[model samples]
Target: MTTALAQRPPATAAYSPPSYGLVDRVAGLRHHSPGRLQLILTTLLTLGLLTGLVAGLTAHSASAGTADLGNRAQPLMVEAETVYSALADADTTAAQAFLAGGLEPAALTQRYDDDLARAGTALTNAARLVPDDSDAARAVAALSTGIARYSALVATARANNRQVLPLGASYLAAASQLNRETLQPKAQALFRLATDEISAGYDAARSSWWLILLLVLSVALGVALFWSQIYLSRTTHRTFNVPLVAATGLFAVLILAVGVLFANQRTHLDSAAQKGSAPVTALAQLRILVLTERADEALTLAAHGSADKEEDFERASGAIYFDDPRLAYAERFTTTLKDRHEAYLTIHGQVRKLDKSGDYDGAVALAIGEQATTTFGDLTTTLDQAIDNRKAAFTDEIGDAGDGLDLLSVLGPLLAIAACVLALLGIRARLEEYR
Candidate 1:
């Protein structure tokens, strides 16, 4: 059997898949027709850049917040504490010298001078750190003016006391009033402001949820790209795409590392704020209260018949001993303070009674002589010990917080860059197969 053969038809033109030059491909991207290889490349590149940018920005913010918490906020708080203590001690020392009459010890005189100088320096330093338009700056300015007036009043009181003038007591009382009513409150406000700033830094550092979300998106994109490579391999009958695999693995590792580091930093910073900074602030306020009470006691002695000073003392002491909720955190410290303060108040009552019963000499002896050992002296001693303990605790907690953030700032951006580069290389390698 013979089979008949059919003639082939002539082809007019060889059919070709659409081809694009570099410029055409670039233009096609804008027009949304850059073909599969360009689209994949562009998507991978864009994702990598976005992921890297997010990581870098987040890392920078975290680093800045951490730095402020450790360096600026803590130091400002310390300086504020110094300012409060120095001003209070100066007032206390001046009163003691006044009570000593014209025979004021040379050591007490030197101590008063030193305290004033230290307070002045600390205030200046704090002012330099704060914004010029801020409330802290205004408070420092007010304090500067108040301290000058205070010095003049104290000097006048000293001169009058030397000449055995009763007006000396009035001048001392005025200075103490200026401090308790105006200057001390301003100082306290400044301290509170500094604590607020530290709290803000902590909040900023803790708020990394956006970064986490970005990481999640990047991870999801990485997984998708990785599976796309698997799809490509299956369709092309290839074994693997090494670059894509590496990119995915690097992204996974980077995200995991960032999450862990961020979590740890947040934990430590939160602990510091809760256990360290907050308690220190409370203790500092308590210290201010103690100093104010001490100053009031002395001023009342100077004022003699004035009920206002005594009332002020009662109110101030009541705020700390009975009213403030913050003291609940340090029950032991608060209890110790209460006991010492109650004993001091009892001695204070006896001193007042002696003065009122026509025993000026006895009142003076009880206030500044041997009887003071169980009253003002005991209260100050216990207060000092408590302050020291709180300070030590603050240091330990803040130090631990700082230690936790040591590695994050450097590692975060680096991993991000690595992930970005690997992604670009992976997509480029896949695209080269088409070429």
Candidate 2:
């Protein structure tokens, strides 16, 4: 089959037209058409993101700060109390030994001496940790003087008793009076100050909890606003401005993460306080109660055995005033001391009976054997056990509290960085859609 070939005319030289006259108009229309809404949204989102991120970081920092106070400040305060307690115990023991009229049993006397030395050393160490020149510091200084005076009086009493002089009872009475008047009130004041410090720490921690919730709410609202913009632009067959979406998403994630971490830290701190620290405090109080009772008992025995004027005995054995440090810290001590005291009274009754029957040696033996040897020592050991147990509990909980806060401290900043990066990527992708 023969096909007829059609010749195509040569293509006319391509006609060049002059560039459009309204170039500016075309450019302006392209710039103004969809850009206003996109620009507004993107700017709003960016500002919102920035606000959220800043607030989130602030909240996280606050939470960490509160945790630190709880962990560091409160523990130091507790340690101060421990040192004070040890000092009081030492002073009480010394008074008891002085009451024995002659030099006390070598071991008992040594304990009193050692305790005094330990208390002095402990006070020095505690001073280093305490915030300088606070009420706590003043109290510690007062207590140190009281302890020193008490020790000197006890020594004088011992020297006089050794010489078989009437001065012995007077010296013993002075030592006990010093303890009741000067040292005990200062110690109690220190304890109260420490308690206030810890309570303030707890308040700071609790306050951060509300901040986390507010941060979360802010993040949620920012995210939802960004999402609404995205939906509107997509249904209209346009890309929502990339910067706005990116900024919003970045901040939303940052704030959300911060809020979550802050909440977690708060919970951890609260748990530590409730389960570990609170129980320990309760146990510590119980131990203090027992020790106070023992101290009172020793003082009672010393007063009874002393050969002195009735006024001397009354001064030596009088009630430890409400302002006394040990007495103040242990308000329930009176009841606890009384409870333990009945046993000592029975021994006292026996000692009196022996004396009435013209058995001076037997009475002395009974007083030393029953009252000094078994009951007082046993109760002191129990108190020590309780104190040690609670201290351990507080130590363990502090570790956990630290771990929880450490995690929270780092997580907020990391998430915020990630959110910013993600938002930037999202915005870049939206920008490409327009092209």
Best by the TM-score measure: 1
Query: Candidate 2 lDDT, tens digit per residue, 208-272?
Result: 55565555556564655566566547745656645445545655565655556556656666666
List ranges where model 1 is wrong by over 4 Å.
1-34, 163-170, 209-213, 216-220, 223-227, 322-335, 356-358, 371-375, 403-407
Name the 10 consecutive residues with the lowest summed lDDT in model 2: 9-18
RMSD of 1: 11.4
Under the 3 Å rule for N, CA and C atoms, how many clashes does model 1 have? 0
Q: What is the C-alpha local distance difference test score of candidate 1?
A: 0.71
Candidate 2 Cα deviation (angstroms), residue 241:
8.1
Q: List, residue by residue over 103-128, the lDDT tens digit for candidate 1.
A: 56787789789988998999988887
Query: How much is 430 displaced in model 2, in angstroms?
Result: 5.4
- What is the C-alpha local distance difference test score of each model? 0.71, 0.57
The clash count of every prediction, one per candidate, is 0, 8
